[model samples]
Target: MFVDSFSRWMKLYGMRRKSDTLAFVQKFLADMSGTGVPRSFWMDNGGEFVSRDFIAFCDNAGIRRTYTAPGTPQQNGPAESAIWRVNKAGHAARLEAPRLFPKIDFTRVPGFGRDGERLWRESCHWAAGGFNRSPTKANVGRGTCV
Candidate 1:
């Protein structure tokens, strides 16, 4: 998943493969609502982002790519923190599902059954709601305007 710092919007992918990353980026660019193509992209030094194909794609799109220093993920702190919060929301949703919807028979959801699909859907809603309702810090002085 990738997070936009200013808008706090996220684009999530089901797969972790490089091809999936490419597809996500393509979709993000095409589907962006308010903002146009970003001036630059900041990411960790992952093979998926550094691959030849990805590099060419970014070059063609005219998007500057900046990578965090190896082993220093803090340089991409906002994205990292967003990832953690998203995952935590998933965990919290899974734990709360049975209690909140006791009659749903979560064990029979099919496919990735046993609450898998339901949990994922619920988690996404919960995370988005939480993010929207949360107050943004008033830090115009520091340029943290989300």
Candidate 2:
């Protein structure tokens, strides 16, 4: 997910593999939200962001990378906080799926295991996107962001 520092726009992606970051970011860069390649990326020291393909793409795009100190996520505070908020909302939204839409039995969804992880993931996506677009005290009077 790419959380814009200024707009707090959270791009929640459902990735099946860690390497999917490269593809997702590439697609994101081509989308309307990506007006221009960001000058730098402040990220965690995660293997996904440090993968060879991701590194190569960032190098070619001239996007500088800054990793937070190991074990210290607060270095990237705002993004982390936004992620927490989105996750909390997403979890609640997923739990309320039955109540909100009783007709669909998540456990019985096609192509998903009885655990319903995929179904919950879809709910998370919807909930996060809605939270992203909702009005916020921090964004008052600011122009729209994708």
Candidate 3:
């Protein structure tokens, strides 16, 4: 949902890391493929989603990419919800370890870069698996989402 190489803000003297665009895209594709690709994908005007390689990949995969107008993120509600969930979960996880503070690098794992990219890929795999196993309020029967 959030397709940026990094989204960390400089709080003081250090940087907040974020997931790389390539890794996120690969995981996103894998996740969607498992559930059946949607008819369309809504995105922002970020360079990450507009990259030549990304656009070509989407085109080849027969996925339609829809971009929201500049400064109009509300138009992408589903994506915004997904991004909010990811960020909220990540932040909640970090908050549980407040004692670590500046000593830890929570954002480092999710952000871009060789190692960070790998971490993000793994996180997606784990997340998808977990979500599939977990029961959803929308589901009426006693079965997993996937």
Largest TM-score belongs to which candidate? Answer: 2
| lDDT, candidate 2, at 28 | 77
State the TM-score for model 1. 0.79
List candidate 3 stretches off by more than 4 Å.
2-20, 97-137, 142-146
Better structure of 1 and 3 per TM-score: 1
Better of 1 and 2 by lDDT: 2
Q: Report the Cα RMSD per candidate.
A: 4.2, 2.7, 9.7
Model 3 lDDT tens row, 27-105: 6667556556545566788887788887887888788988999999888765565555554544444444435565766
Backbone clashes for every candidate come to: 0, 0, 4
For candidate 2, what is the total of clashing residue pairs? Answer: 0
Candidate 1 per-residue C-alpha lDDT over 1-146 given as tens digits, one digit per residue, 9 for 90 to 100: 66777756666555646658888888878877466888789999898899998999999988999999999989998799887887888877776777788888777766436656545655765675566456566323233222
Positional deviation of residue 59's Cα in model 2 after best superposition, in angstroms? 2.0
Q: Candidate 2: misplaced stretches above 4 Å? A: 103-106, 111-116, 141-146
Sorted by TM-score (best first), the order is: 2, 1, 3
Models ranked on lDDT: 2, 1, 3
Best by lDDT: 2
